[model samples]
Target: MPILPPQQRTDPHPDRTGVRQAEAALVEHYPRLVRLAYVVLPPSLGRHRRVLAAHAVVQRALPAAGSRVRVPRVPAQSRRSGAPQGAEPAPEGAGAEQGPSGAAYGWMRLRVLRAALAHERRPRWWPGRLPAPAALRPAVPVVWGLRLFPRAGGVDELALDRALSTVDGAVRAAFALQLLEGLDASGARELLAGAAVADPGDAVRRAARLGRPDRAGARAMLWSGEFDPCTVQTRPSDLLRRRHRVRAVAAAAALCVVAGGLAFAVDAGTRPADDGRGPAGVAAPALDPARLLRTSPDRWADTSRVDFTAWPARGGRTDDNALLGRALRAWAEPPESVRVSTTPGTAAVPPAEPPQLLFADEVDGAAVVLFHDHADRVVRYAEPLSGSGGAALDFARTDDADVTTGAAVVVSRTADAARFLLAPWIAESTTRDLLAPDTPGRPLEVDPDGVTAAVPRPGAGGACDAWPVIQLRSSERIVEKHAFLLTDLGEPAPTHLTYMPKPGRGTPARQPREATGPDALLAWARTACSLRALAGSGVRSVNNWAFAEQKLPEGGASADWVCTRADTWRGPGRVLVQFLAPAASPAAPAAVVADREDTALCSKFGQHVLAATHWRAGSGRWYVLGAGSRAVTGIRATGAVRGAAGGPTLAVRAPRDADVELTGSLSEGGTLTAVH
Candidate 1:
């Protein structure tokens, strides 16, 4: 019933060959597209904002443009190529990027990217393949992306996302060049030109004009593309290429990234401060925690409180110590979230107004508050737990920040006397034989409080146990001849307790067994009062790397318990636990090796230890885990020297001045070549 309008006649479909389409699209939007392409690098850069404008513009235009394009055909092949069949067209013959000449640049990029992505060659071609990420034709983004779409021999999610989103050749090329190549505008242009794309865009053109390397800017460009899956390591193929490519890019892209670094590109990933040697020479290799306030002003993400533009400018580089000191002072001041009130009182210029508060965290997302002391000594302030015992705790600095910021902790308590466990000393300790030939000179010292001082004692020579000796404190004074860690079941208390002191956990690498003490606690050299052999034997060492009990003290009963295994190291000898029974009789002591399986189970046995004992070498006595012979008097004889497997290695003490070595493939028995 409807009358048809004059028969619509469609002009014979005009050839939209890939090349024609690429060229035509370039003609229309080369400038716009090139600008868009250049911004794949992130805006996080410090200095240059080359493509930010382009990123915004391209994002807008991409959705509206008729971007679909077909392959361009060669004149000779056009006749035999079935009009639209057999041979896929080449992506060739376009100019490289130039702001003024971007059309030519965009066109050229179109060709190369098409060829690269398609696994096809341009005219004047003999068939050959490209860098295929896969064994098959073209390359897949992932083994899975291709398998999911089996029809497409070459498959990639980034490619699929790009193709599905943008049909424009110039847009497609831009995405590939900026993100895939990790290039800044100028850098991208140079590479694109080599691949035959013309005048990229104004952003790139400006970077090229600079001539000198802008490494910072280039890195910024690369990161700007970070949100796009293609740029970041999204797949296994990218991971495999990372190591080799890291070296290659480090060599190839150092200069361009100079600009990115300056533009704050590195801030996104924490680059170092500059020294002004040169761009490369200026930037530091670490992100100072003090400077963290400059970048992340608010931990809770309140934009209203922090203006990104002026946040870093708020406080011109506060000293790390000053920050920590102030934070500590602030922590000590209030009961909850603190608020400062100022009146018009003239009090000597109002205490020199405090720096803008970047963040006033109470305990800083960590159990302990970490900061640098005025002397540059790294300090901690820990949150206190409800006290059941240990009377009081101590707060102390472990090491200087310039040297180590290892496992951070908080200073919860301040005691007259303090205990410490040094990592490096423990790492290097060669604690093997504690059973001396004769009743060793003196008994290991322990204090009423749990602190076992490992610091170098007055006038000492060799390291005790090749480490520091454990000391206990009675109130503020060092308690002599008392080792609190070891709790002897007999009337005379045992001195040495668990070897290595650490948080308690379940037995690892072992079958569940019965434990006799309060909840299994961290393995300290000091044994529990219930154990008989440990009575009066100074608390010695805990097998930190063993699969024994973990809980520290738990009212005499807790979780799964197990014996330890022997663990030996090549250079450091071995670490293990020993059980000394009713010290009057030295025959029944047992031992357990700490590094039985190199910590096959990490949760339970993940603690370090500090211990000391005496070893006689010639006339000189060496106190294990201490500094010199003076501490040798602290050693008490134990009857047994057991290996890691919960058994005795020797029933009686070995002769003094004898170099004893455990039997192992790595042990050949060496002398104590002491090097002070």
Candidate 2:
């Protein structure tokens, strides 16, 4: 190996010319940058700290060839007045066009201000304190030297400074950017995003309040050293930490005491081990059935009219051994003073009849009955069929009954037969529509003016259950329309029925629609997708694509898809779909992408139905796809919906492919048919 003579190593130190150029530029821009930093930072930090922080920020923002850098020209009108005109426009390709020394004066100013803002991460609850004018005199000589206010009819400089100090730190930063730096709303918002501000305009507005009619003048007054600095010697950070620690300790101590008490109570109340012989043959303590049912307030006294409906049990007969039977037996014979109807075969009443009592058998081996009176009182009774004749009962006056006409009635029930009654007189009426019909053998009825109609429903064991459409009418007109659905119709029929009101159908527009089947879901998805698109397109768009991707299914064709939209940024925005792929044939890349695009589009535009209207699952892997986008046009799926042997393929139909075969599976027979 021939060893070449050692080449002399070049010195890594910067050339003398570069050092002088940098020094010259720093000398030119240092004052302006310091002023910018001083105005923005003094309100939050100590005078000494603010000046030091400003120097650091300016040094970092300074160009290497500082002396050669050209100061961006501010329009004459903007500099002379505060009419939003003086700031220099950012140069195109700032870094490239400006070169190492090409950064615009406005750019440097903003950088320094932002750096100062970030220097202190003030806690939300931190009470800001400004430094005394005397302390700031050494660092902000220009501001201190200026005569802020005239002697006659001018704003009080001291009052203005105190007001500025009282404003939030973030708000003060926004004000400084807008009034002092002349940045517009969009620019301020962009800069404030890192400072945890949701609305820069709001922040500006809050800060502007302190300045009033002449914001610029008021700001000038504060900068002119008119106010006395706070005399408190406490540092904001230290005080905040101490306060937080004290609160935390107090909370912990209280929680420990509560936990200890709860533990002692639980230990003392532990029941003796139950043997097979049932409660040691002890007589059970009696409970007031009325109290058990009083889950909500009562308003039944205002009720003037009541209606009733009854349906046969889905399995054909009521449970003879239900706990409800025990309740019924306990209260079957009312007190002598109370009125009782003992007619055996009269349980069936005409639709036009105003029967005070309604009876039905639930699929869950329980019998349920509801009773209402003119006084707006209601009693709900339910019993399990497995036990011999005892029922759980609840009764209360309707707290939300109509006080005037007493014709309006509201009944809210849970899956467990817990009932809340409301009278129309006291309750607000909002119209809603039923999305589906009632279950087979589970007839639902609605009566207006003593006229009723039996709601027809599909038979039991169907793929889906039936829901009822109810129209609540008053003398004026239909007060509210709603569709009610029971999740569990088995014994005691779910006390809770979901009330879904139709959109744009005599209801408040801001109210959210229920997330039900494909159609409602598709609508919701469209809203979410639109919001995502808007946010993504906005200046502060956040790219949450990774989060969305994580929610997608790994390996299957989906049975259903959901697109959820959140109004706030913190909420989730994504399209989730599940597909089944047979264990034999894995889903192709195109198929997976198609499903994701479908969901994403659904989320964006609220339209889920694509060329492929329906999908089915086989014995394959299932995959969930979560696609996130802030833009409405974030993900576009183009292709004909086609069904293959393994699964469905939704091809992206772009311009290049003019003629494409579109196929779909018949939900009935799983037969493949050409759609387009």
Worst 10 contiguous positions by lDDT, candidate 2: 538-547
Give lDDT tens digits, candidate 1, residues 414-512: 222222322111111111112221222233332221113222321122322211123222211112232222121111111222322222333222322
Q: How many clashes would you count in candidate 1?
A: 123
lDDT of 1 at 88: 29
The residue-level lDDT of candidate 1 at 334 comes to 28
Give the number of colliding residue pairs in candidate 2.
Answer: 81
- State in Å the error of residue 512, model 1: 11
TM-score for each of the candidates: 0.21, 0.23
Residue 72 shift from truth in candidate 2, angstroms: 19
Query: What clash count goes with each model?
Result: 123, 81
lDDT by residue (tens digit), candidate 2, 418-517: 2212232222222122222111223223332121232232223332222332222233232343222222121111111111122232333222233333
